[model samples]
Target: MTSRALVVLFKELREALRDKRALSLLALFVVMYPAIIGFTLNRIIDKAGSPEREGIQLTVVGSEYAPTLMAQLKQKNVIVTPHAPLDEQATTDLLRTAKTVAVLKIDAKFVENYAAMRPARVELWYDSAIDNGRKIDEVENVLREYTSRIAQARLLAHGVSPVTLVPVTVQKYDTGTSASRSAMIIGAMLGSFFIPAFIFCLSTAVDTTAGERERRSLEVLMAQPVSPAQLVFGKLGAATVLSAVGLTLELVIAHAILKWLPLEEIGLSWRLTTADLTFAILASLPLCLFAAAFEIALAMNAKSFKEAQSTLSFAILVPMLPLILIPMLDLQTATWMYAVPVLSNMTLLRELSKGADIGLLHYTLTAAGSLVVALLCYAFAAVRMKSEKYVLAV
Candidate 1:
């Protein structure tokens, strides 16, 4: 059994190495994917790290706290403009005209409440229609942080310890290692990008293999004394190796770019160790196997080359759905997250990026499960190929 598998693997590798199309595709990924990922990552970091001010004009209505707040805003490089009648109606009008990016309305009892050490209320009015909800959230966060600091200072001046008000400092202790955190972030980002590529590659690869079978060349090869299972395994193995090579190149280039990108300037370290790279490869292996197996089955079942391509393209939609939704919701990697097949790989990648240690159980289970699925997919394809109807349908 071992010898047969080895022979099959070797044949597939040699065949893949000699195939012009396969070589070109692998070379393309080696050159393009890393450049694309590196450029994209650099752009993202640049946007976030930019120190340029937006020059947003903030209009303050009826605030007794206007003087202090305005000074603070100026210090933060925001232009403050005092507007008349700090009422809701005037504030609304200002926001509508874009005369003010933000409007601040301090309650009438702001001075009284501060003197009494009571909780004071403040209102910020902004156009929610512009630039999504993020700008509003940013303004609110700034206000909250500023207000909290002032309240804490006042309490401290009154002989009250700030720790007395909030005694317990909540610290999150994770059982997982640093690799896990890094994997979680890196996995998600890379998965979003690579899974789609894997799915697409599978479609193309299957069209090259099983689609050829539908065209009769596959049968010509199978009849040459090799078993159908061996033939199918060979094709799958070829696809896996091509995928791995492309992915490896992308990893190497991305790592080199990250090493010199000065990520620490933006409060991040994009460094990855040898162990981290191994974990990333391991995490990706299952997805690659699944892609190959699934694509082979789809292409085998397809009536034409076009049909195989379409089906494989549609299969990508499933993985892309999570890729889109996960980051929007800002979901973090957790124990349960590591069990969700493709999602687990993505989460693991992200955690690996942040230098977190992935748990052995999680790693082992993900790889094992994917391998099992891949094997089952191959077996199913083999069984279906034995059917005269299935073989002749294409």
Candidate 2:
């Protein structure tokens, strides 16, 4: 019986390999996804790192009025571009270009107000639409320091204590690290990697089941000496094996690309060592099996290849719903998450990427949960293939 099943498996795999269209689809996904992700992350790293090398550009309208303040701004790595007084429209046009972080306009009565010990005003002009909040905050900090110094000097000259001006003081400290900050972005991306398991096997599963029936050969194959269970196993095995191999290759290539890129620059980390990657691939194996088995069962019910393709395409979303919805809900990982097939695998990978030390029990549950589901799907398919109704339809 096992030998017969092996024969069926070999035949289906040989036919799949000969089909250039199927092979091309498999190759494209294995290469394309990793390349796209790697390129995107590399671009992000470049953009995040550029600001330090290129200092902030600040446009000051009344630099002559506040030479002391202007000197203070330059000392803090700001490249000050002194400009003559401009109207609101001109300032708007300048900010729209995004050439400068912000415009600092000192009031025309700055010297008069300073000499009179009145509070002087400064207008901070910037395009709120742009993502330059960090640069703007730095400019504000410099201005506050300059103002505080002048206030202290004036109080001393008046023989009054500067301490009397402040009733309270506040300080802030951030406890979040770069890795934790980046984990959210990277976690979302990790969930998408498992989607290809459903896609890579669609062609093979559809071809073997619905395509065989459409060509009027399913009945002839059913008449063979092997039992229905053996035949189903053979077909399911072929698709599952192909899906597993394709998914594993995609992971390896993606891991290599991720490792090569300097993610540390952006506070993101892909801490998956080779052993960790191997374990992740192993845990995901049952997911590939479940994908293939589920698709095969759905495809077998279709009358034609196109019908099977369409039906199974929609069916693929069943597994994908968890991957998408769970992340959107912003739910934390829990024991229950390890029991939900695709979602479990995604959660495991995400935790692993974050360098978490999730125990072996979670891994066992993830693999076992998918294995149990795959077995049920295969059992249902085997029983359906042997039914009188199925035989008559074939």
Candidate number of the best lDDT: 2
Q: After superposition, how far is residue 158 of candidate 2 from its true place, in Å?
A: 5.6
lDDT of 2: 0.87
Q: lDDT tens string, model 1, 59-119?
A: 7766446467666666665666765665567666767886567777777788788778887
Give per-residue CA lDDT, model 2, range 190-306, as digits (tens). Answer: 777888898889998988888887776778888899899998999999999888999999999999998899988887767678998899999999999999999998887776689
Off by over 4 Å in 2: 148-182, 391-394
Give the lDDT of residue 289 in candidate 2. Answer: 95
The TM-score, computed over Cα atoms with residue i paired to residue i, of candidate 2 is 0.89
lDDT of 2 at 229: 92
User: In model 2, how large is the Cα lDDT of residue 363?
Assistant: 95
Instruction: Give the root-mean-square deviation of each candidate in angstroms.
Output: 6.5, 2.7
Best model number under TM-score: 2
